[model samples]
Target: MMGGNLTGTVRLTRLALRRDRIQLPLWILGTTVLSSTSYTAVREQFPTEADRVTALRTAVDAPAILMLRNAPTGTSDGDMMAFQILAFLAVLAGFMSTLAVVRHTRQNEETGRSELIGSMVVGRHASLTAAMIVTAGANLVLAALLALALIGNGLPAAGSVAFGLGVGAAGLTFAAIAAVAAQVSQGARAANGIAAAAIGAAYLVRGLGDAFGEVQPDGYTMTSAWPSWLSPIGWTTLVQPFAGNRWAVLVLPAVFFAALLGTAFALADRRDIGMGMLAARPGPARAAAGLLSPLGLAWRLQRGTLFGWAVAIGLFGVTIGSLAGTVEDAFAGNEGAARTIRELGGGGALSDAFFTAMLAMVGAMAAGYVVQAMLRLRSEEAGGRVEPVLATATGRLRWLGGHLVVAAFGAVALLLLAGVSAGLVAGLGNGDLGDRLVDLGAAALVQAAPALIMIGYVVLLFGLAPRLTVALAWLGYAVSLVFGQLGELLNLPQAVRDVSPFSHVPALPSADVTATPLVLLGVVAVALGAAGLILFRRRDLAL
Candidate 1:
């Protein structure tokens, strides 16, 4: 007889692969491109060992840089590249794994597909087992691709392998965490939120540890305290792929993954199908006074997410701002680094350039939330929740408009929080609170235009082709992210780079603010949003 609890796992695994053909390939391709391109760019940027060493020294002393990237192990190009991109790659892998796990496990359950499969030859544990296998397989594939890409690009094979494996291990760790989170939350959305929060907390812990960590003369990196050991992401840094390849460090994540998987399976056995380990509590017998309108309902649905995003993004801003003093100190006497900083900042004060980049990144992150907020409409429709609301006096436009308003204004609020937070921290450090707050806040606001434009594009897709909204919206975001963040580093063609909305945004504080592009972007955003609303009103709901 087949394994009692995982009899149909193989079949489900194949089915999952078939279902995820497009998504899986895209994830793999994106990871590969980002890794290879980052290595290539770093190698090209610092052609000589002397240049690499100088860059490393400067970066290592900058708290902001260390927080964002790992400390360099040596002056070698591979080491520097690892320092520059490994943390980012690890985080990316974690994101991919979390989404993959939740999509196949909790999401399938929410859609009632798991029940259908269970009614067949599938055993009780079959679906979760299949999901784990598929996600783990995807991580392994990603690891292989990353290693091959790095090796082919001239990085040492052993180090490349270690780097790839470390990243893959991180993915597996997060996949296991997501599985546990799935067992804890009743709804797919809640599961995803929990998983995402875990990922964010992991990154934050690592960043905090790294920020306060010291790099010794012997090339050993030490965190300020033991907090680094608390995070899987932090464990990846200890792997030190190109530096020393601490193979023993790999054991940490492996052990954690095993424990998390065991806990998840145990929890799964305890919960009923379509339920979670934590029982859902009943709401109030009567709706709250504020729950009388469509806007109120939308706000209630979105408030938790909005607050989470704000707090996370605000803390990120504070971290970035707090590092400004260290950046200024580190680069003050380094001519090569200063020149590079000026060029990157688009020809203004180095601090301003840094703020400009930070603001841009915050805006991009906020755009992701904006798209998710807008897509809540599609989610509600698919769940048959929107129809009931529509059957009320609430018109389709009002229901849709309520979500759009939240997305638009929510994006603005997040940007403002990030900017003001960053500015306040930096100003307090430098003793210029008032001026810096106004300047940085305005810069942050400027970034909102491009974010709004991205929202408009999503709306256009949602209205014009509802089925393709999620895929197309995310694809667009990925393209924009790569171009906006890496275009200059990769030396991508200006024409290709120009496709990102951020390309049109003035590099504020570094470059003089021009109203023309801002005006054009604003006009386009309004026009696209109006068109989307109009089209959405005419088309039948996808549900």
Candidate 2:
């Protein structure tokens, strides 16, 4: 009987792999490249032991930096690199794992794909088993590739492998959490959101632990606080890749995965097919006034997500803005570091330049919000909700326009909120509260133009190739992010840099405001959006 429960596991695993062939490779390779490139840049910037120590000291002295990045165990090249990049890599891997699991398990059931498969002589556990197998395999591949990349960069093989395994363990832990979330949530979206929230919470807990951690007498080493023990991300960092290489730390995540998997399996047995452990509440029999129109319905669908993004972005902005005062003090004697910050931030006073760079980074984050907001259309269409809506008095164009309006305005609102929060914090200390608010607010708001461009391109993909829209839209965002953030580090060509809409936005406060790029970008965004709407109207609705 147990054997029968997983009878089709192998075939289902193969099917999952086939579906994720492109996506998995992209996730793995993209993560590896991010690590490898940062390693290269770190090596170039800190050539001597003293330089590396100074860099480590700079980070150690800054509590804000400690809260954002991990506390270093030493001043070695590998230690610095891991301290700087590993946290981000772990988060990325966690997201990839959670999304992969939910996509295979809950998403399949949500779309009725699991029902069709169940008609065959397959075991009840086959789908979940297959999802775990595929997600686990992807994490393993990411670990191996990342380790190899580090080894290729001349790091010790043992430490490289340890770091890779640490990241993989973090991802696997989140995958198990996602499995349980899948059992509890009625819909794929809620499952994904729950798993993602777990990841975010883990990161925050780890950050708090590091921020309040005790510093060693050596001044270059520190130990995380007790909060670290509660987070998988903290556990991964405790693996201490280059410093201690604590192989035993990996056991925590292993135990976590086992416990979560057991709970998920038990819950799976309790839940009915196409149902969750927690039942959805019945809605009002009559539609609310806000649900009467396409625009109203779009707003209702997106408000929750938008509010979440607003809070996260606003807090991040405030955190970054507060750091503006510390920049000069931290890098006072380090001309090389100062020069790099200046270049990133643009021209003017050192503090102004810092704010400029921060706002630009904020702009990139806002663009992500745009991508997610625009993708809601695809979600609606894929879930068969669009048909019922269109069956009403709504036209295709009105429906699409309603979502687009929400996405566009939502992006602007988020950016402006970030700006206001950041500017408010930054100006309070400088005694230039009014001036700073106006400048930074405008700088952040200008980001909306490029963000809209992202929306247009995503809509275009949805119109032309509905099936490929999700993958391609995210791919486009990743490419643009690489171009905007890493172009200087990678020494990418200017022509290539031009491909990202962010590259065109004028760096504000530090540099003089220019209207030409902003105007042209707006024009291009309008044209792309118009073309997408026209094509969407002409194309038949995707089944």
Candidate 2, residue 281: the lDDT equals 86
Clashing pairs in 1: none
Quote the positional error of residue 403 for candidate 2 in Å. 0.8
Give one digit per residue, the lDDT tens place, for model 2 in 168-223: 99999999999999999987877877887798889889988987888889776789
Error of 1 at 362 (Å): 2.5
Residue pairs that clash (backbone atoms under 3 angstroms), model 2: none
Which ranges in model 1 have alpha carbons more than 4 Å from their true place?
218-226, 318-331, 335-344, 424-432, 464-468, 527-540
